[model samples]
Target: MIDAIMPDSVRTAGRALQVWDRWLLGCTFVLLALGVTMVYSASIAYAEREMQNSAYYLIRHVSFAILGLVLMVFVMHTRIRWWEKSGPFLLLLGIASLCLVLVPGINAHVNGSSRWIRLGIVNIQPSEFMKLFMVVYLAGYLVRKQEALRNFTQGIVMVSLVVAVIGTLLLLEPDMGTLVVMTVTVFAMLFLGGVRFWHFMLVLAVGLGGMAVLAVISPYRMGRVTSFLDPWADPFNSGFQLVQALIAFGRGELFGVGVGASVQKLFYLPAAHTDFVFAVLAEELGLMAVLGVIVLFGIIFARAFVIAHQAEAAGQLYSARLAQGLGLLFASQAMINMGVNMGLMPTKGLTLPFLSYGGSSLLASCMAMGLLLLIGREARAAAWGRT
Candidate 1:
């Protein structure tokens, strides 16, 4: 009825506006739905073996998804100024949580790395929340110091110091994967914030150089690099995970065996429901599933930048930077996880954003999406001349 009264041009513009906000929310829902189904499929065997309950992970995941959705709604409704003002405190709180994870008794140590904090029902990964906080904190910082950021010393140095401190704490947890993602995302945000090209390049160079040194110095990391180069070299040992993942992909071929029918997730693939869920997904759903997931993410990644541009046009610098940072955060993590599964990159303990079975990750991704929605709402309002 509304469309009938409007002119054709106005109706088309309305559809264009709907495309941005609707696509973001729509793609996220699709991913989250897929996450639930895939998590159950990939974890059924493990959950049954470990917890004696076939639906253990499924129940927990549903619980967290509900919680995350609730939180996302709250975040979207909250005032923007509140988030901007709270960024610093949230960043400091994230730093504190990271510290807590390193302490004895309180920290949940797993696979030689201390990353989670036992929160009764769920073990929360501080690094996940840290990424969100860093984006929020940095976005606000960039907006506050826009002019200063143009200067090499005042802007870049100050931000780098904070990131360095966070990186050191993350290294203490030995979460090099999260550290790399966080660093790269920060660098990408810096570029979007309009930092000088050379300064941005310098930061990128230093970050890359530091990663190389860290890899060379650490036997475990170096082994990963070597194994990634040739997972077949020691297929039953260090390269076991990637080799199994590849096997799963090969089994998947073009179409997939069937849901809940992945042989690899039965016992061969480690972290089947977590880091390697994509492999299990491929084995069960085939190449078409992979392409679909990639396309959905492509829409999300591209739309985030559109929202950022919209925010910029609306004179919302903080929102613009936040959207960009969050966009890179999602895309980088997803790409890295998929790359690892495909044997294109060294194995990293990164979740595939909304698609992985991790409470912290799901919650963080939801909150980030909520913020994007908030920004998008304001931009639309500003564009439409609404109060």
Candidate 2:
């Protein structure tokens, strides 16, 4: 009835909306809903003890999820050309925010890191925005420098320098997790942009070597590395977090003890609702549920690559690179978060994309997913044009 009353153009767009990527959209919402449930479960005890409100974190997480969904819808409707054009500006804004967060008296210091700006009741983390903006900037750069990318001086060196600058700024915030994600995402984009294999390997070696040196120079990072190697060696101190995480997994066994039945979240596991939320999830929901979550992420990553390939095949280099970069960002972050939870990697302050309780990370992830959907829509339109 509404369609009958609407104009033909409106009806046409409604039909297009009906054909948007259902798999991507469906997986995103499922993870989001699951996240809300797990967050409430993981945070209720802590919230009650600290704030006298059992719904504190859950309320905030849901509010941010709603806001992120709105931003996602807006981005999905906006033209891809706008993002391509505004890429540089967004990058500059991200850099400026990073700088602002490091300034004394302006920055919000929390847990020994100056990585956020306090806004009344909320703390805004700039590094999260940096990941998305860096992807956008690099996507545009890859398109504009496609021809030059094969050359060391024009392509690899220039991009590396840009990444280095971003890394330096992030390290000042001391956000090693975001820096790792950003570096990997950019390198993946360059490789997909057809930089020579040897050049890619040389740059990768140098980047990894530099990170190793940074880790060695930092006492805390070195402790994390050593503790990760043998978490049981100092289980009470340096390895406390990882050891608790492993215990959550061990308790989970095949099936979870049941939702809200987790003992680990009772002040036993650090960051049970934030960085280690996945561990709490495993404890309450079990190995089966954890595997399901992993499969959902795998599907999202696979679909991203499929969309990227379609865009590339349709001759949309900008769209292709953007999709590729988003794929890398999501996949790498998810892997890192899960790895840390399962004790496969050293702990870092990275959130599970759609499943962790974080406003900035959720918003940035929704934006990335929205762009992927937009790219898929355009690819379909281009295909139809050829037909």
Candidate 3:
């Protein structure tokens, strides 16, 4: 009816949006569908306990999913130039938001970490915004300073100083998890941008060593590291989360116990809807579902890199690096979340991209996907002489 009342040109423009990669879009929505199901299954009891309504969590999840979907569509149509031209502003915004989260009264603390700013209805997690903004800004930097990146003083040092400031603020929030993800993603982008191999390795080593030292010096981080190493030894206290995650995986030998049937999500597993959703998925849907989710993400990021390479072949260097960075960001975080669920790594607050139940994560992920689509479309258009 709205279309009927609107101008024909407007209707035509509305229908002009195209999907360059069906696999990317398909896999993402499939994960979102599964996420909706699992979030309800995992959060029903917890939400009831907290809100007296079983559908409380589910309602919020769906609401955010809808909002994210709209944002995804809107972003798909946004001019790619806007992203590049506004890179510096976005970076400033990211930095300011991160600093704001560290301020008293403005920042919201959940589970002891102040990583969010309450914005009336939704809590904004600046780190998520930082991830996307940093990628775009760094990609533009690579394009502008491609030649200078080979210099030891000009390339890595400058980048390191910038990230160090961001990293310090993150540590103040005590959100080491986001810091780790952001650090790895930034390095991956730098590597793709042709930062000297020796420089890359040297900085990587220093970064990892510094993170280790920070972890060792903090009692909270130390406890987590120790728990990850031997959760069984402290199963009742420090190791409880990992132990329960392991139990969920163990219970999911072949087929899952069936949706909503996992015993662990019944207060046995903490963060069943967020950090540990993959484990809850394993418990309910079993190995097949687990492999399926992995394959979906595999398709997503594999296509992402392909898009990056295609963009490169078409002489869009910034677009290429942006695609690579976004792909690596998704791939790295997904692997970490899954590894933590399987007890292969220390538990972190990382969400499994679209599969986890968080409004900020979902929206940010969808926006990333939109960027990927935009990049892919531009690549194909340039290849076909449309540019």
TM-scores for all candidates?
0.94, 0.95, 0.94
- Worst 10-residue lDDT window, candidate 2: 2-11
Estimate the TM-score for candidate 3: 0.94
Candidate 1 structure lDDT: 0.89
TM-score pick, better of 2 and 3: 2
| Backbone clashes in model 3 | 0
lDDT of each: 0.89, 0.90, 0.88
Model 2 residue 90 CA deviation in Å: 0.8
Candidate 3: segments with Cα more than 4 A from true spot: 1-19
In model 2, state the lDDT of residue 145.
84
- What is the clash tally of candidate 2? 1
Tell how far residue 306 is off in model 2, in angstroms.
Answer: 0.8
What C-alpha RMSD separates each model from the true structure?
3.8, 2.9, 3.5
Stretches of candidate 2 exceeding 4 Å from the true structure: 1-18
lDDT of 1 by residue, 1-387 (tens): 323422112233444343137788779889999999999999998999999999999999999998998888788777777889999999999999999999999999889999999989679999999999999999999999988888998668988999999999999998998998999899888888889999998888888999999999999999999999999999999999999999999999999999989999989999999999999989999999999999988888898899999889988889899989988988999899999999999999999988889899999999998888888877776776643
Q: Per-residue lDDT tens digits of candidate 3, residues 1-387?
A: 322422112122244433357778778779899999999999999999999999988998999998998888788778777898888899999999999998999999999999999899889899988888988898888888999999997779988998999999888987777888888999988888888999999999999899899989989888999999999999999999999999999899888999989899999999999999999999999999999999988998899999999899998888899899899889888998999999888878889999889988999999999899889888876775643
Q: Name the top TM-score candidate.
A: 2
